[model samples]
Target: MRGLREWWRDLTDLVLPAECGGCGRGRTVLCPRCRTALSGAAPCRARPVPEPPGLPVVHAAARYADEVRAALLAHKERGVLALTAPLGVALAGAVRAGLREARWGPGDAGAVRARGPVLLVPVPSAPRAVRTRGHDPARRIALAAAGELRRTGTSARVLAVLRQRHAVADQSELGARQRLRNLAGALAVAPGGDRLLCGGGPVVLVDDLMTTGASLTEAARALRAARAGAKSAVYPSSAGEGREERKAGPRMAGPNEGGGVIREAICAAVVAASPDSFEINRN
Candidate 1:
């Protein structure tokens, strides 16, 4: 009888695709209530207690609970493509929030505009995971987020120049320190990636979620390595940064047009984070 009821509902709506990816509400891709939960909140600062080194100033759109958690899981693990837009919208808000707080220092809040279009750099997923999932969720969301930003008059674009240089163990079971150790120097900027960003705008690292933030920290380290035209021996060979990693890297020039480098770490954004992570900003 429950199955029959669902069938009838789908049949009547004529667009009854699937239940809400968020809350399983019948007859809709995403119900209004869950949609609000996912994208309604103003983005806020999120920081992990005992934050790992190299993790940038980070912001998150929603708390990872209730419908927000459900929607992200469905979209990432279950391949619900329809959730990408809404998730992207939420992520864009986080990116904007991060930019708003980054590097103004009592100056104009819009100072980021003076820099150039915003560039979104997504952390690369493992090739094994991408092959298993059949798509790169982070990259897709970054593209969607860039589209949303452009639509709203922000010059934003996705720059997927970072690559996973080594495979990492599953971080789900690891603690903060272990996660950081596992991800150390695991990412590298691709050839010519530095030139792409040399004359470009502010960069924001984008990802689906931030738990320990180990992934984003590694990404920032790689970007910094590329920008400075230096190879970082942040970890020993045990961390998997091999001899090839010692080669000269790309150069991400600063705004000075000559030999300047952006020394400060970049910001990062995510759809949701641990609920407690948001509490740091409540003050």
Candidate 2:
């Protein structure tokens, strides 16, 4: 597994840089042109085909292509830490878009705007990956994004309570099912973390990129799996649910009844997603 991980890391173009993260324009970290490319568009639904069962509706600020792809690799694989800000800004946009249309479940209902606090939970990177990179890209970006959202007047914070439960094979070449099986039971919330989520607001799964939606699915599974026994509260899976709950305004659940419910978050956001995933959403 270690060798496979190293081989997969090598597969990415982690070349040392001398130019812009996006278009490699000289004398800039990210040129104006590439920055615009990274965030110029409105977020869109980018659902993977054969979408994993527990995966929620996800939004992406840009397709993972051209400059967006280049920039992501530069920041994540090559450790260009400066890119965290702009990438986070892009992710913030995606989070807003995800919240705007978020449904509590699969029932064509529950679309509430995140007028209050928003919790951004990043998918956990592998321990080995984090050690190799020297920083957790998703968490770093999530913090930047939380700042961006607060600047824009929506109360927000990054809740990095998820952790990898164990190592798995490198997922670079795995099929959708293969990836799912490999990652199944692979993530869990930090001990007592769900206690923080037992109240109000939307909980969004955040990630830098989405290739097959496997990691997000696993993250979601872990969140729902935790024993939030009182209300047994969960935002419930699916993209088209969440209407009445918003109007009723959940309180912390005691057995999900005494206090507010964790806003039953059932949505996600990403900086970029496979261009094909966006295509699937359009059709």
Tens digit of per-residue lDDT, candidate 2, span 1-283: 9999988666643543357899887756789888988899888888888799878778899989999999999999998987898999999999888766643311222322333467899998899999999989999999999999889866788888898888899999999999999999999889778876555467888999999999999998887666343234453442444666544542322231344434445578999999889886554
Using TM-score, give the best candidate's number: 1
lDDT of each: 0.81, 0.79
Q: Which segments of model 2 are wrong by more than 4 Å?
A: 1-18, 103-116, 227-230, 233-264
Model 1 pairs whose backbones collide: none
lDDT of 2 at 187: 95
lDDT of 1 by residue, 155-230 (tens): 8899999998878898889999998899887899998897666657788999999988889989999887786563
Q: How displaced is residue 144 in candidate 2, in Å?
A: 0.6
Top lDDT prediction, candidate number: 1
Model 2 lDDT, residue 263, Cα: 42
**Candidate 2 positional error at 20, Å:** 0.9
TM-score of each: 0.81, 0.78
